[model samples]
Target chain A: MTATATNKQVILKDYVSGFPKESDFDFTTTTVELKVPEGSNSVLVKNLYLSCDPYMRTRMGKPKPSTALAQAYALGQPIYGYGVSRVIESGHPDYKKGDLLWGIVGWEEYSVITPTPDVHFKIQHTHVPLSYYTGLLGMPGMTAYAGFYEICSPKEGETVYVSAASGAVGQLVGQFAKMMGCYVVGSAGSKEKVDLLKTKFGFDDAFNYKEEPDLSAALKRCFPKGVDIYFENVGGKMLDAVLLNMNVHGRIAVCGMISQYNLENQEGVHNLSNIIYKRIRIQGFAVFDFYDKYSKFLEFVLPQIKEGKIKYVEDVADGLEKGPEALVGLFHGKNVGKQVVVIARE
Target chain B: MTATATNKQVILKDYVSGFPKESDFDFTTTTVELKVPEGSNSVLVKNLYLSCDPYMRTRMGKPKPSTALAQAYALGQPIYGYGVSRVIESGHPDYKKGDLLWGIVGWEEYSVITPTPDVHFKIQHTHVPLSYYTGLLGMPGMTAYAGFYEICSPKEGETVYVSAASGAVGQLVGQFAKMMGCYVVGSAGSKEKVDLLKTKFGFDDAFNYKEEPDLSAALKRCFPKGVDIYFENVGGKMLDAVLLNMNVHGRIAVCGMISQYNLENQEGVHNLSNIIYKRIRIQGFAVFDFYDKYSKFLEFVLPQIKEGKIKYVEDVADGLEKGPEALVGLFHGKNVGKQVVVIARE
Candidate 1:
């Protein structure tokens, strides 16, 4: 057996301008020793799955002080994101060889990581699908939990509206709202996603936003009373329309603005006066902020998953070469569900 | 005195579009009984000081289900707003002849009101100028109180920004933030108002927004560490700039959008994605929502006034004839401070 292996990586060509193209990412090959450095508390892992998220688009943009949560991806370097991996070697006290984990990892076959608590998690439940770590049981799960329950401050029998409904976070947010006994409605870009929301995810109502000329009228139709909680996944015109349709004292938990991420200049939201008129609360949040609540989230959602009370779907793209297209497809709403790029089966 | 007295009134000529003008208001005189009808459970009040507030502009717009916290002013009818008045006659158990109160009253010489608790506050501390009830002790006061302390959730040593800083609510917000030990910066339309913000309102820094070509650059210059709490009065471009300059987990208390109220199509606020990037919370609120906290607010600010620790400034427009210009001048940023139209001194 060789001590080193060839590692393939996806590297950003340059900082993106408008919408990112698949060609913006280039593949590179390098050889690396499959061992952690002596006396270093880092862990070496083999990448299994890489999660494609809307926030990734933000990271692709030109680096600025005001750029959201994640720092901009460096040119000619392998982009890192939430991924499932198996430890090849461990110098970290908490992890051991063959231990599965999920966290910010390079989009390469093998990479060394300084395992920080919360940022990286040693997967305990191998009972569930290990690839679920890239999505349902990982960052997106925590995001939906914190944003819907905490930020939204939801109540039973209230109405909820989720945009990007069939995506990793939105799908879970809809289910969580329903479990809380709230009437949940969702908007997705495709008819297939809309169907998934209504049929598979248990959303009370779902709409293909592309089919609706007037988003405000669509929201009014879906929520005859008014939207009490808006899980904002898409920004721009959708946000403007939602502002007009929101109920008095409505809460908008902004998890992501997928639509605005790719635009050079973000669309101007005009119905902001409705914010004051409705006494609405629009809160923007990141998953990193609520990492502490992860254990409690796992406790709540694990049972639901085991009992079939909860469901998760993923659009898996096989192999490292397909990573760029899988990610770039997210902005186009080409993925029907959670987009995950699989590098290895085991 | 005659049983019937001629009552002079400022009437809304029609529903206003674009910038409101003095011509939008028409004055008329009609006979009033000067006494409440027997068993009517109402009080007849002789108007003294009428408040000219920016939110009143929303009331003049064509009525819609989403017309903010106020109803539209009916054409050819007397407009109603916060005013201080002396009770000429009373059938309500809560009020008596010669009692002074402040509430929603007709913009007329004498008005009959069915006094509701909290909506109408009887003068308890008459030593302070009675006209103050139209501003410092009234609705705008409560607005500043609720928005800054409760919504902003300010911490000591936080950075606070106030827009339209020389106006009624903005002045109070700056002062309150200063009292909370926050570093306060404010933006006003003119040089004189900017000086008033720093000197009279005790704002740490002040800028004339009209002179600055780039609002965001001005904010960055003032808030080097970024704004922790923003008391949003003027919306549109100012709000967009504030969003860019907000610190992580910043709170924006949206009180009024005077800039957008007069426009046929409201300006689009493009920086909303910052809500998530910075984890910002933008809350829209009304004074009506916080009336329950009135006594608590009074207890907090009344002592400050009595000790001369707090100072209030008002640009007084004398006589009922000047009420039209006084109210309309608010949109033009012509009023130096809290704009008040005095109908009678006693």
Candidate 2:
């Protein structure tokens, strides 16, 4: 790269409060050289697929003193997330030109990555859909695996509950629990998602939490004996209800709390006393910390995928301009399955 | 064995709301056969000491329609807790007449117990004060050991924070953390408790949270870098503040939430998102669950006690009549250390 060139990007227009609107993000095109600068240990990569996640909503807001995990996206910088890409040019010794990798990349068509070795992982298995690297083979996949196996420590014949059931991580978690001989139940926002949980993902039971006025009662009806583990994705009233229906020594693996992320004030869980009395273990985990186990996760999940033991669905929005809307769609449960933005097919 | 004479005891008067009063528990006398009925595998024991724990306050209230864990206390029954006793008569094969043991007995003078061998452990170490069976040598001891070692998974030089610092389990936890070369700080309700934490228990630093209006500031002042392990006994606002000051990968062993027990409605923790940000592990544990590790615990703690490396404090009230007051005082933060009611010295 001769001079620093600007890249076309989707910039966060303003901080979001409750539900993110289309006006919150702006897509503008600018020219940039798709190559690494001289004497720099960096690589220029064209973005292939961008992962749309609910956690990205937290980054769209102004940085509050109390906000945990991620910083707010700057007013005009490109919104970022996990993306699958190809290295077009390389300045680092380990990475070479035309190496495929998946890690943190920008929302634009091309990103100049400073090749942080710890953050990026080189792609080994290319047989699976490259978009699978955006989800089932990537962050969401590891999240479901580690959050279930390590945090939940699920036992066979135990009753398992997954909220946001048809979403990326929730769908996989429900499947994983079922494979372990658990009685899996999931709650989604719509009839379609609920039906998908039972028919597509093999959940023992599925319910539309939106239609159920009494969530706790619905949980009781589904799990007469009480739930042994809860995969908490959508926090708030659902969390409060699940707490009431959890069996003694129940484990809650908190992967994401999408319901509370966008709210001005987070909902209070009234039945937290259950945690003490029933000896329930509620643990929060990040997939980044579980990167060490990624290879092991791949070893386990890859074979399952090859044999059709595991299946995945993607809701892909084409073009960089649609990236902002696709990312925002996650907060409102707009995506049918794994919401991914396809910047390029190859 | 013969029919037992009438025994006087304190029974829960009614379901409690807000702060408990002495009048909530009525002192009454009731008749019962001390001997185990023919062919019944049960033991009758005279309660020697009664333990007053903060958790009992939750049990005294009206049961919420939520979790089975929050079962309401039955009216007119003697309040129950861990009590050290001598076996007066036995039908159980494992326990003989005059055998000393510690387990769930009753608030009254004598109890006919259906011995659950797994729960009731034999008092092997008679060298220590038998009343220590009510606390440091009993449930509280196992709680501190298991919560610190198993839940916290502490390392040397790690920063540890204990809430309710001078109470039964908190005192031992602080000492255990200290013994492991952890930088230990604790929070209590009173100046006396703060002093006890520093002088008697050897806490690295101590603060009276009641006096400190800004808990986050206090935590920041004490732990500039942030706390690695937080032993949570008190919940509500304290928990909210601690969340802000927790270091990444922090482990929180939730033993009790005494602050929320008496509140008619539970307080919402505002900073729960910090758990995700910090990748904190918050696990709720019951001492009863860790009974299997008691033998191992005794093996570790007994040596330390014998070598004068470990010390303990007890706040004992004489006579069974004061049991109600002793138990109620826990909520008010009146007890200096392990609060025990001694029915008789000999």
Candidate 3:
């Protein structure tokens, strides 16, 4: 129990501005004793999988008062986000050694979690892959569920459009919309992702936005009736284009604005005028708000996953050193599905 | 029954592009037959007052697919809008001669109207001034009512920010927030309008946005706690500023974007990412959509108007010929309050 091991971590070098580069982070190693600080309510866990998300880009920036929506990720520290882990030791009564958990954890080989409110949740079901906790059974999953079903107020047979459709959240949203008998269309950045959305996720249609010189024309070609519910993952020009193509009384659930995250100046949405006549509603929601229904969500989504009614895709990169590339690949649409970095099998 | 008379009318010369001007319209005289087309359901009325609104600028634009929210006004024809009138002829079973009405009518000394859905609501109460029908009892009133009470979902003690705060709709919105026990603050274009907001309209605080170098700083001064509900009328930079100051779970009821209407390039809003952690909702609604709730709205607002709980200000201009000047003045914030043109006092 007193033996020490090398703890490898990916640390942010400084707060970023403009497009994030791999050099923004440094891979460093430190020594750790296999023991929890005595009398502290912290749980020591061996990290299994690390999730890569677009929202992490926002945290990498220097904090602004407006960025208070989510607390800014502190610089010169190991980046923290959703991760799957195995508890090796515990000072908290609710968690014991050998228990599994998923929630916010540092991007490292091992993490000592001082549990904070809404920070972590005990893992009950292990029949599913542990890495699922980093994705489909994780924040992105809850985001798709709440953003699509609740914020979108989707009705069966309505047309649903998801931008960044092959990313972690978009893939699930399109699948959920299809499950509800919706006419689902997704726009991805690359041909492979677009094809994956149509063939694997069963979207009614999919388009590569990069290929479509005019997004409004591309949307018109995809959904002639216009989008009823838009799971808005990418903002900027896509949003302006979607505004022009929405139907009367449409709802846009702004889950993320991936496109605008890296730029110093976010692209302005010009066609917001369409929101008035179309009686449109554009609302931004974070998954944390809907965490109270996590159990309800698990009960609803688990059976579908087990029954093969839902399929999840993960772009897995092995080892902690690969963290920077996996995280940076997200901003470029370099990965095809849920981006995850595997630290260990245990 | 067939006698003809010279009727003074304000006609649009052509579609407008940029800020509207007085030259965009022409003052002319035309002949009215003083009789409805034989056996038709048309009603001939002598227009008493013509309402000038910012939305009319959108109507003056060359028709685009998005302008389809409200039908565009035809060029080479007398412009039409909400007006107070005395019925001189009627072929519909709903009314007969000498009846008073407030609804859509041509901006002329006399107009012949064919009743259309949502275009007209029969005036059941006239104890209030007939000119009140053009504003306080008409679209702007309903607009403020539905946009605040219905869309805002306002709660007592919540903070509300109303832009264009001394205009026809903004004035009423501030009053309604006050009556609801909300802390209300309004921003107007001029010092005079700002004074009116605090003193006459019962706003807790007011600001002359034009005088403030930074709108965000002005808003922070007026609402240190952050805005709970935003009544968005003047969009562009003001909307961008408001977004930066909205509280968590705040709602923005987008009424109109008057500042963007006459511009060839609409200004872009940058701080929309605030919607995420703040969990803010921005919804666009039109009074026409809530017409089914008209009876309910009148039941709620009529007593307040009669008891002097609500005070309305009108910037009355003389004659039908003043229509162009009055209408153009709105783009420049020329009118102090509700802009109305007196076609004929009767």
Candidate 4:
């Protein structure tokens, strides 16, 4: 006879439309064997923390061809996302009991996963907060690393403008630009986030996008010399404005368009003709494409974290029951920084 | 003593709005000395053939910061464009009397221009039709070479799509992709142009965009594997449609936006989010940036022309008096190929 334990999970009620609310998710409890099945490569894990990301919103929409990158969440099932978990039992050769790892796992108290390359990254440095694995050490961290260094091809003294600059990925991009000796400005939805960008993220300048009447005018005021690189996060009107302000031979690394994910119809961008006039290059990328460099990313970032040269902030929700509200709050800009749902501390 | 000649010219009436018409341009006759000024570096030339291109539309607009690349055409002055000319007098060291060249010159019978490195190129291969310089060997040819080869980065067996397929630049782009062993498709405004693309230009398939109700569906039908490269000549709705049908890691080279250049307000492009999902790279370039590679371009194309492997077509307007109607006809899709105003044969 094998040992068994109760598993609590946050389940999706149905395919979501428009802005997702807490009502779109439900809770369920089930019993599972604490041990991995005989002769299986699966590892049974106890979920510690779950990441609340803007990309998760794309997964909530009804199944469609465009959202093929991230598959639609299955109805009446535990929604899966990047999470930090501890292996309770394992039949996989790479993982043993008590091994820490972060990757895609269900929104639950316990999960059974088959470890695969990129699907799961084994944690080596436990000296830092394990919760950081859900964000600054996980997918969002790699996104900032690859999107900024690889895609943006940043150079010293160049002007970098990041929209959604106080969020998980944006905050880190701003810091990285600062580290590279770039002149960085960020835009956030709230005054508090704007302050955090300047004070915490070390941005040269920060603006509350919600307070600005005209985005183009705001950009013109901030970047009088014109923008050399744009880290595009919030699309729609912001992208249109940034296009007008981009310098000749400028580059735009498109990571996310959070502003348009919830809308039934995405907004139309009018100033794309500037792409021609300014001889701009716009490239889109997904973090998964750069996961192979996770080890190199950790090498670059972990040192800064330990030296206190880099700072990170988390708006964490306690317990699995709070996961629904935490994830939904991301769309409303209710979370101040990297939003995480804490399931269990150890 | 210098000889004088009657210089018949076409002058812009004023900054244009909406669609430009023949009435927007007025005729002027001025007597000019057929010689470069003493102690001046300028070269005097008799304009033989003036090339009518879509980009000239931007110059006709009211002077603004955005149109800084090509300065607005001076109001009530003879408009300038790429033209084939015979030098009658030269004070510059590089050019001499009786030399043929292709570069920017006024839409007049005679022009005195100070030729710069990129502004003028001395013609060497005159075995082909001299008119070819106005279209195939001139600025439009260089635009196609740089935009397709450097920007698109095409690989063999990729599916390529070109808009405005029978025009000067687009025609060359389609043929270049075919030469690279790629499957090429093109879209034009009329059946005649479509037939020319499939038969004359060797495109795998061709479509008349004006007849297609759903542009995306039409693309899906033409490219069952999705478009790997998009030569963006006409912007607005076509760009939005191309975004939906782009393959993963596809590339788009934005050469021109003839469809939107005449509009007071450019049409907003939706579906830009596809850039992220598809990991697409959209790059805009000006041929002026690639002028240094003109010799390599000539080396590549001259042999093809000599071997009868290249073909070029021109819709020649008879005289300087017909320049206004010929240039304006491009907006109405009335010209079948490269439009040229022939002021003189020799």
lDDT of 3 by residue, B88-154 (tens): 9999888789898888898888888887768787888877888988888889999999999999999
Q: Write the residue-wise lDDT of candidate 3 on A1-346 in tens digits.
A: 5877889989999888887889999988988777799899999999999999999998998888887665677777899999999988999988899998899999988899986555688889889998998888989998998888889998999999999999889999999999888999999988899899989999999999998999999999998988899999988999989998899899999999998999898788778777776889989998988888888989999999999998899999998888899899889999999999999986
Pick by TM-score: 3 or 4, better one = 4
**After superposition, which runs of candidate 3 have C-alpha atoms over 4 Å from their true positions?**
A1-3
Q: What is candidate 3's CA lDDT for residue B162?
A: 96
DockQ of candidate model 2: 0.57
TM-score of each: 0.99, 0.94, 0.97, 0.99
Give candidate 4 misplaced runs (Cα > 4 Å): none
Which pairs, if any, clash in model 1?
Answer: none
Ranking by DockQ: 1, 4, 3, 2
lDDT of 1 at A57: 87
Model 4, B1-346: lDDT tens digits are 7789999989999898999999999999999998788899999999999999998998998887855466899988999999999999999998999999999999999999999889999998888888888888889999999999999999999999999999999899999999999999999999999999989989999999999999999999999889999999999999999999999999999999999998998899989988988899999899999999999999999999888788777888999999999999999989998999899986
How would you encode candidate 1's per-residue C-alpha lDDT over B84-189 as one tens digit per residue? 9999999998888999999999999999999998689888888899888888899999999999988999999999999999888989999998888999999999
Give every prediction's interface RMSD. 1.2, 2.0, 1.2, 1.1
Clash counts per candidate, in order, are 0, 0, 0, 0
True contacts kept of each: 0.82, 0.60, 0.73, 0.69
> Candidate 4, residues A102-155: lDDT per residue as tens digits?
999999999999998988999999999999988899999999999999999899
Task: Give the alpha carbon lDDT tens digit for every residue of B220-295 in model 2.
Answer: 9999989899999998889888999999889889999999988888998777777777788888888877889889
In terms of docking quality, how is candidate 3 classified? medium
- What range of 10 consecutive residues in model 4 chain B has the weakest lDDT sum? B62-71
Steric clash pairs (candidate 3): none
